[model samples]
Target: MKTLWVLVIAWASVAPAASMPVCSGGHRVNCVVDGDTFWWRGKKYRIADIDAPETDASCEAERRLAAEATSKLKDLLANDFAVEPTGRFDRYGRRLVIVKIDNKSVGETLIAAGLARRWQGRKEHWCPAP
Candidate 1:
């Protein structure tokens, strides 16, 4: 009985290493990397399910938009926002989080602003299908 109790305690103390939980707590943290990619809670995060133009992609306008979107995101966050994970991870192994600041979604904002396009498939670049 004592051995079982000790084992249970040990297991309880171990934090889950895979699949981050959805944002349940109200506590917010600082943005360490705000350039299209960011980190929080000792975990590196990337916006999931969206593909923005790359800085050097085929489309010159898109590339510029990518940079602009990145900059805008940084400005919008700027240590004044809260985020919640969608309970998913991207291909790069970065924790995918749905961000909100002042009850506004930063991703949707970029989309509405024509800064980013919806991810067609599961890749990092945006491409339209025929």
Candidate 2:
């Protein structure tokens, strides 16, 4: 019983940051860039599991959906969450991470809500090309 309990506790601490660091020393304020990107303590992180519509969307529908996804992302980040580094970075130089809340993926939440899609090796269009 004791060994089992210890293992459970240890596993829990291995991931989930609990809370991201706040801004200090005059760095940029922490904020979400889009559904799958955010800034924390002056560093940018791209969510590794999903690809959301770009803010500069090509179509009106895409633009609107992008805004909705961005808003949803903002609200989700307001509560307790975790940022688990993926040991990789995007071409734009943003560190990649998997953000989770209580072990549930933030990306999956957005996907369920029709706000985002699973990321493939390359970005898939949010809408048909113009």
Candidate 3:
């Protein structure tokens, strides 16, 4: 019985937990990774419906937008949200998912807020060509 209790406690420690707005790196289990990705219970997930600006983008505009988008995503995930898998994974092997809160798509929310754009099956660079 003691051994069983210890096992249960160990499992509980590694279980998926409440979302927290943390993106500063280093093995986060349940925290936002960026504008379009996050970690939940040691699993990485990519938002499947929209593409937010990338933090590594060369353009300053993109970098700023990425920060805002990331912040917005963090805010949304801070509450009770659902991670519905699309049964797919991106080229990078991140599980594709659509996050929702109260049946409203989180991607749509980011789009409405101008922090992200609909995923059109192609990469649309957020920086304008000089």
Candidate 4:
């Protein structure tokens, strides 16, 4: 029937529009929010598969490491980089992504540098207990 054909066409047109936005090509790094997060083209992104010390750290050692992590991440993002989405989002609504600088994962770089740790479904302390 003509009506059925029209309905089918309308549905098909709307389906693509309703799909989730994909970040494939990547975005320019606008600024680093912290060690594990950054802002890109007005969107907040969290580094995937890694966790860094909180900027508002509780202890002196943690605070120092947090600052170091932030600085290191900033330096990395200063170069040409791309963000590949992990098909996930954090609780804070940040897009989870693996930041690649010169084709190398920034998260892995930070981990190797002792600036961050691999995320294991939970946050761990960056400073040893007293």
Residue range with the least summed lDDT across 10 consecutive positions in model 1: 12-21
For model 2, residues 4-87, the per-residue Cα lDDT tens digits are 998666543232243433323546557777878878666888889999998887788888898888888877877777777777
Instruction: Give the TM-scores of the predictions, in the order they appear.
Output: 0.61, 0.78, 0.83, 0.76
- Superposed by TM-score, candidate 1 places the C-alpha of residue 1 at a distance from the truth, in angstroms, of 32
Q: Cα lDDT of all candidates, in order?
A: 0.58, 0.78, 0.83, 0.76
Q: What are the C-alpha RMSDs, in order, of all predicted structures? A: 10.7, 4.9, 6.9, 10.9
Best-to-worst ranking by lDDT: 3, 2, 4, 1
CA lDDT of 15 in candidate 2? 29
- In model 1, what is the error at residue 15, expressed in angstroms? 22
Residue-wise lDDT of candidate 1 within 32-69, one digit each (tens)? 33334655555677665455666656766656676777
Cα lDDT, model 2, residue 54: 85
Better of 1 and 2 by lDDT: 2
- Residue 50 C-alpha lDDT in model 4: 95
**Pairwise lDDT winner, candidates 2 and 4:** 2
Best by TM-score: 3
lDDT of 3 by residue, 1-130 (tens): 9999986554332223355766666867777877889888779889999999999999999999999998888888877777777779999999998888876898999999999999999889999999
Q: Candidate 3: lDDT over CA atoms?
A: 0.83
